[model samples]
Target: MSGQLFVIGLGPGNASQVTPEASHAVAEAEFFFGYGPYVDRLELRPDQTRIASDNREELSRANAALQRAAEGAKVAVVSGGDPGVFAMAAAVCEAIEKGPVEWRDIDLTIIPGVTAMLAVAARIGAPLGHDFCTISLSDNLKPWAVIERRLEAAASAGFVIALYNPISKARPWQLGSAFEILRRHLPGDTPVIFGRAAGRPDERIEIVKLEQADPAKADMATCVMIGSPETSIVERAHKPPLVYTPRFSTESSQ
Candidate 1:
């Protein structure tokens, strides 16, 4: 009897953010398949199998997990943030379609969790409160020229940009290029917030002038939030601790 397969979301970085249902799913699974760093977060359970590796091995790892499930092992394919939100859920779904795995009987569930996009938006007050669009600046899976076109369109249309996969160890200039596209259509003083290792150790969240967003501070773990003209930072206690971009205000009509 092929057992159930779960695609569970682990949330950003904090274990505390893990839902009780997610913990239960993890405990019940005979195998936990996830990114290498995510697997390290859970305390080692001897009876539970772990399939973890670098991002390059994700396809293979996902295939192995599906194979195990086909063989009737209860498997949990884990991802940081909502599995369906720029995570491994789609991989598991696509692999099942192409592989020999029998999905007809294998119960598959995608459990949702807090995504970095929403968290970063909250930290910056409400840049996302208005109409916004999300785009990944990475070219590894998608072409760079396509990304440039989309960036241009989004900026021209006045949509706040939530850029994922903004930068990493190898592709450093992607974000800079994206910024350049935005600068052509967006105001230079527009607010941009960079969230580094958000909710994790070495966490650093800072707001900077749009022109000053450094690519060096980013990695695969970071999420970049670019505000529309409406975003503004407010002062708090002797410091500016807040930002907000209202969807619409009478002030903009003048």
Candidate 2:
């Protein structure tokens, strides 16, 4: 008898942000498999076993978790933020598609949690209140040219853009290049938000203009939001400004 497998998202580095559904899944799982830091977020009981690997070993981790589940172990594959959003949920799905026939037969459940972009948006205001799209700035899985094209297209189309994996040691130049691409289509005064470790104790949220947006301000933990032309900032006395995109668009009036 094959056991169950749960793909769970832990939310954006905050215990409070983790959904009840995800907590239930975590409690039910006997074995957990995930990247090192994400697995570290779990406060597992003595009976629960954790198997951690490097961040880049997603496929191998998924296969190992599936194998355990096939052998009747209640397994959980974990990711930070939403599992489906550029995370381990897709990795597990990819493994299932190309993995053994039995792997597909294993009972699977995906538990959702708050992603980074949502957390970041909440910290400031609703930049994602209007039509928007997310793009990963990392070029490991796809070409940099494709990223550039998407950035340009999204900007030109007036979509509020949320950029994940904005910077890393290996790909230091990608975020700068992404900013350059957006500049061609967006005005120099467009508001750009750099939200780092949002909802965590060490959280930092900064807003800047598109022309002055510094890529060096970001790390892998940051979620950068580039506002559309319609996005606005409302200033308050002695308080941080609220950044948002109006629900109504001027283009719609035409």
Candidate 3:
């Protein structure tokens, strides 16, 4: 009667982004777990038991989910955006690695979904056309010094940044700190997008200059995208803001 544990990704905000695999995984689950905000994203049947909590308690919640699975409850541990990308997958893995639950034979799977980085990239018209990398500015998991080194490396390497977990109530200055470091490599005119709750009802996309990317307007639900040096802000006469990053073919060598 051993049950399977699924780290299901719910995508950004809308139920429309939910993958068929993820949907099927949830449909088969007897129990579910995820962040409080993302729990509201689903329309599950009444029989499915759900565990919801804030980001601060994500690890504890995930551990409890695994424990439930070990106790023979079919389970799904949910996460918004992509589970493997700055979400609950790693946390679940780490918890399992720590041997908190003595059961080592439990079934575990990581289901992928569309992330906010790709969603925002689509909204801004291929700012990720070339090379790019994603990094979270939060120092809670990793050292701030290590994150700074990554930011500097990404900047010098000309990799466009898809910054997750940019700012929150407690870590208000994290984004600003990374931006200050990136500005040294990227020009101040580079396009920076503030995407709030991407794919949700209150979703907002603000295109601001690098110098004016205000961290005050950001929170855990937000994803801040900073483009590379070649990233262009092309404005058509009537169309909305369009971001274009040159590909190898598009770039003309002198």
Q: Compared with the true structure, what per-residue lDDT tens digits does model 2 show for residues 145-202?
A: 8998899899999999999999999989989999999999999999999999999999
Q: Give the Å shift of residue 123 in candidate 2.
A: 0.5
Cα displacement (angstroms), candidate 1, residue 221, comes to: 1.9
Q: Over the stretch 47-136, how does candidate 3's per-residue lDDT look in tens digits?
A: 988778887787898889888988898899888889999889988888888865564678998899989998888777988988999998
Better of 1 and 2 by lDDT: 2
Candidate 1, residues 1-254: lDDT per residue as tens digits? 78889999988878888889888888888888888888877775889878787876667777888878888889988888778877788888788887773665688888888778877766556768778888978787789999999999988777888898988778888888888888888888888888766677777888888878777767878888888777777768976568777868433433
Q: Report the alpha-carbon TM-score of model 2 versus the true structure.
A: 0.98
lDDT of 1: 0.81
What TM-score goes with each of the models?
A: 0.92, 0.98, 0.92
lDDT of 2: 0.96
Backbone collisions counted per model = 0, 0, 0
- Show the lowest summed lDDT stretch of 10 residues, model 2: 245-254
Off by over 4 Å in 2: 252-254
Index of the highest-TM-score prediction: 2
Model 3 lDDT, full chain set? 0.86
